[model samples]
Target: MSTLRTLFLSPRVTATGHALADAARRRGARVETLREWRVPEQQRRAEGSSLYAGPLFADAVARELGLGLLEAPQDWLARLPRELTLRDVEFGTIAEAWRLRRPAFVKPPNDKSFPARVYPDGSGLPGPDAVDGTEPVLVSDIVTFAVEFRLFLLNGEVRTASRYATRGALDVAPLERDPRRAEVLAFAERLAGTGLPSAVVVDVGLVDDAGWAVVEANAAWASGHYACDADAALDVVLHAARPEGEFGAADRRFLRPAPEVVRD
Candidate 1:
């Protein structure tokens, strides 16, 4: 049974967000686009509500509604074995990354706190004046991906996937048309039930010279569907953001910390 009765969206809507909202409506669920950060009084009294928005907006609304948003641990990618990652990756502070003398790919683990890109050297990174040196970041050896696909995983299986990029450019296409479809599915199967939240997004790609490698994990509630089946993506989003009381023991460990709520 679906646990979603109402789907709340952030003030800013994207194409993917509209698709999800339409899908939710087709499934007999009411959808509402939030006018502001504050949850409306009617929604506050509604039952079985779930949210799909950016990390910051999702966190605030989820806190107000007592919902739990599931996401991979900040260092989940960094902890994966070399066989899966296919390159060296480390989780450390910006201050630590600033000491890198060689080129590397650096990004924040869960949010867009900083621009995620390759830096020629430490000097290319944001200085202490623009960002706090203590912020966490993922530093990885630079590599090129020929193509990248986004997999929306639910219950340890890939429910839907879409080719989201080609050679670092936005190129959305159905996964079924790709000749590498079988290979991508097979590689993703290896990561089934591998400690990620039951519903999450995982990006995998074919490196220029390497085989398949994981790009990163993202919270399903905040992920873009691209060409993925909107209905299937909606299913993942429902599971990714649900009432806190319904969380299972396994899912609890992957829950994102609740945001602090201030009341007048």
Candidate 2:
């Protein structure tokens, strides 16, 4: 009976955002889609120099979409707002960071962060200049994890959870251990203690064969859509909408609103 305005961000249509958009349409709510980065006309003209252009375009996209920006704080480079959450590992100094144990992880602290290439805890990945050596960088003890889990959060509540055995980019397998399963779910719950955005994914992994650790929180927009259950994932996402059939067609959907007209 009420109308709401929602904005979803993703480089491309993703499962989480798609479901949310579907729900919103069914509920008669308006939804808009935006990307993390949008290259400008002039910049794109250069052709071969778009590698470092993500941030520049992403900033523009944030303005166009009228939504708060997200970033991972692991590197001093992310340049996030102070009030935004900072990762524990994104410490300012390597001297200070030495306090952390080896075999932990060093990753970006925010959602928009491109995943940092992980380095072993004490393997001298950084070399002599590692800490005092270079500009501000994100570093953490490599997590000697026993298990990893990905949990979905819809409007601040847990929707569904899945366990993983990851060895690299594509080797993700469903977890087979009860303790690993139990730990991942539990970690997801703990992260909810901190306030998070409306639609997001809470990824948790283990550290040092001991306690469960926070991997990195991600926006449903940019992250993978469905790894565990597609329909269930959609249900949680579409909960905010009206009914399912209001949109023109379920398969080809458009949530991006028409541009406003000028009064002049």
Candidate 3:
């Protein structure tokens, strides 16, 4: 069997990134780093243990490296507690949402293809030429979150979590025993049973008016750890993203599962 090799394409790994790499190394995986977006043919042929890329180049790099980065399901938020309030605008039908006119929060369902924010209306968005009509976008009713947390999940479990923000400020406090923690864990449990991706980042928040609600689900490989336990987060990242696989369409209700293993 070939030894596992982890690759990262970042000029400088952040503290969290370094921690993850260190964790992988501790687990006996050889870690490699490249400053370029493109992986050489020889490097790509090695036994890949894991891969992480910068946000700006993540999607493109993943495609070139054939990494499997699981994304959030389109209708996942609707299946959670805040479904009644959150809305979805399909790629080709966003004009209808714009017709609604009422103020609402808008963002791409998976990728950061476009900015996620409150748009006054369809007119507020960039012209049609700038927005891809094939990518689905989420337009939700605006709500206030008193606290927000990011949970790294694998095999229907919360491996590690962190309180990244409180109220509106950018905070990085460690998670503690609180009602919010319990609430988000329960939410994750329910989401796991719903046939979500094998590994993922489930973001939950304490809404000032709506109690605990889901904020969004992001790909673990591309998400920031904030104050999360580096070792634990690394575990989730390992399974969540891979060097190559063909996704199964029926594994998750909406989200796809990674392909079968590819050994060197």
What TM-score, computed on C-alpha atoms, does each candidate reach?
A: 0.95, 0.49, 0.81
Clash count in backbone of candidate 3: 1
Q: How close is candidate 1 to the true structure, as a TM-score?
A: 0.95
Which residue runs does candidate 3 get wrong by more than 4 Å? 1-3, 54-56, 79-97, 177-179, 245-264
Write down the worst ten-residue block by lDDT for model 3: 84-93
Which ranges in model 1 have alpha carbons more than 4 Å from their true place? 262-264
lDDT of 3 by residue, 169-241 (tens): 8877767644466777776666646646767888878777656667888888778888888888987777766
lDDT value, residue 205 of candidate 2: 64
Per-residue alpha-carbon lDDT of candidate 1 for residues 90-182, written as tens digits (9 for 90 to 100): 999999989999999999999887789998988888899998799889999988999999999998789999999999999999798889999
Ordered by TM-score, highest first, the candidates read 1, 3, 2
lDDT at 169, model 2: 37
User: Which candidate wins on TM-score?
Assistant: 1
lDDT of 2 by residue, 64-150 (tens): 333232222234222322222223455454444345445545543432333365544534334455334333346643444455566
List runs of model 2 lying over 4 Å from the truth. 1-58, 69-90, 93-105, 111-115, 119-137, 167-182, 230-264
For residue 169, model 3's alpha carbon misses the true position, in angstroms, by 1.2
Q: Indicate the TM-score of model 3.
A: 0.81
lDDT for each of the candidates?
Answer: 0.89, 0.43, 0.67
